[model samples]
Target: MAMIDLTRGLRSHPVRPPASGIARRRSFWERIHLDPWLLGMLLLLMLAGLVVLYSASGQHLQVPIAQGVRFGVALTVMLVLAQFTPATFQRWAFPAYLAGVLMLVAVELIGDMGMGAQRWLVIPGVIRFQPSELMKLAMPMMVASYLCRRELPPRVRDLAVCGLLIGLPVVLIAKQPDLGTSLLVATAGVFVVLLAGLTWRFIAILALLATAALPLLWMNLHNYQRQRVLTFLDPNSDPLGSGWNIIQSTTAIGSGGLLGKGWLQGTQSQLEFLPERHTDFIVAVLGEEFGLVGMLAFLMLYLVIVMRGIVMAGGAQNTFGRLLAGSIILTFFIYVFVNVGMVSGILPVVGVPLPLVSFGGTSSVTLMAGFGILMAIHTHRRLLPR
Candidate 1:
């Protein structure tokens, strides 16, 4: 009777499956350290971007085809990086950051000047790329690596060191006169600091300092940079010059109404009324052709990606993973917000592109690589002993 009672008790609770069995049950994506949800959303966004780019480029098949190639390359890079563990990324973070900073310094000394900014480094026929874009990923990785080793709610001394790490790259990038990338890099590093359980009092103090430094920042701006701010305040002041982009972009978006003019049918783009319709202002092209419904649908996709990122960050097993993932996703949100706001004429035209939707390779590749890190953080978590 005693033996029977014990057997009944043992049978009452089911046993957990062996870890090997769980490992075998992982899907192909899990085995490869990829997040299907995040990957699927990114692919969908890239496909949509190609479709819009086709129209924005006046039905140029070659343009979308080239962009497709870029997406393929970016996805490959993402997949390869995702295979790495978070610890691997933590190990490489400082060296990658140091290399990136060295490249930025190299750019300052001998960079290819184009469109009034010395932001690109050209190595003859080998490759031409922007170091500022590299800093976007490095910034978060570095700050997260730095803080994860220290205590949470970092002490003032630690914060100061983190600040110096962040400020160096920011100052270098800003010297490139690429305000958009500089601010993005700065935001990336700041996100990590904020995610490290920063006290609100410290945050407030930093905010006050930033506000006080605005005048100094303003004084250092180039004439064109200042002009962008003035134009944001009153675009109509230079109707045919600096204001043309905003004026035309707003017109494109407004004309789309609730159900857009239909794909490849926007007058603002097809008739050449809109400038930069394929790049920074691509959202205007989307709004003009897809209308309010399309815009909402597109934004809903972005919202889902951001939500998934938040979920992944919450699930991270360590501080480094959490901080890196959180900062990447938040910076991605800023990318969308700033581009859309600039196109809508609410913010200064800072040349930020809509993530995955803009017609460019460097930004797209950098963004996908960041997402790869997020996947590594989320998918490479170790199972607990049962």
Candidate 2:
């Protein structure tokens, strides 16, 4: 009987061949909690950014070096975060959200002011960063976690609660007068709610309400904020004053015709006519140096990244994973759109930096961490009963 049972077990589970070298290599990456395709694309994009940064910074080596170091730190944070499971993120969502909100409140009370905005919190000789950046991740996490346990196509009560959750931080950040980050945080939370099966009617009604509230919102804008809107409408109205940035940006991009003027050869950038060349307006540098062809190539790469993220979101094993991943990627798309639109003079300059391509520390780290969460959701999936 024992021999017969052993034979039956062997028949039920046949022996398999050993994994090939390629399979082993693939498994090694998965074991370390990394996604090869996503990582590969990100590295390629960052390399291109460094090349553009070198030219944009007047051929300065230090600029690219500093950005490279920040990239390293961001990548390390991503890998560390990727080691955790989706369940861990879900469990910590509420507490993280609460802590982030508290920090935003603290920023309101005693945050350091910089360049005309109270957006940073500094612990003397320790750390200085934006609480709004933290909410960029925390908002989606909290919303996704909240919605996963409830019924799909959420009820009015759930939607109201979610709206309240989203609105609190938005109001705080807007008070800090960082309109770009406030809108970004709001978009992050809203994406999660929308992904949880929001109805088309609710979306339309919300749009109507937002349209109606625009005038009231306009009334409360700061003087500079109002100037940005007016400038967007007609940059030529004040070409040498508040309109200088958009004018120069458009000049740089338009000058970079079919093949561009060549790397490090952009008159607008190299001659110092362009403003913020290394940060918010860096895309214009790429456009000037590499031409329309280069811009399209860069955008194609970005599109691939976005599509890959969407595929990961769809494949996620749980609702929380799907919602969080979808929101993060969609918010990232909004970042790219807003920055490019602002640079091209179609939208107001709200100080949004191009994702992964812009020169900045906090935003880079936040974005990489979000991708890390995505990798976690993808790699940690298991074959569980439905």
Best by TM-score, which number?
2
Per-residue lDDT over 1-386 for candidate 1, one digit per residue giving the tens place of the 0 to 100 score: 33334454565566554577555656667888888788899999999999999999989899999999999999988999999999999999999999999999999999999998899999888999998999999989999999999999999999999999999999998888899999999999999999999888889999999999999999999899999999999999999999999999999999999999999899999999999999999999999999999999999999999999999999999999999999999999999999999999889999899999889999999999999999999999875533
RMSD of 2: 3.2
The residue-level lDDT of candidate 2 at 123 comes to 90
After best superposition, candidate 1 residue 333: deviation in angstroms?
0.6
**Candidate 2 lDDT, tens digit per residue, 117-223?**
89999999999999899999999999999999999989999999999999999999999999999999999999999999978998999899999999999998999
List TM-score per model, in order: 0.94, 0.96
Candidate 2 local distance difference test against the native: 0.93
Badly placed stretches (over 4 Å) of model 1 are: 1-26
Give the lowest summed-lDDT range of ten residues in model 2: 1-10
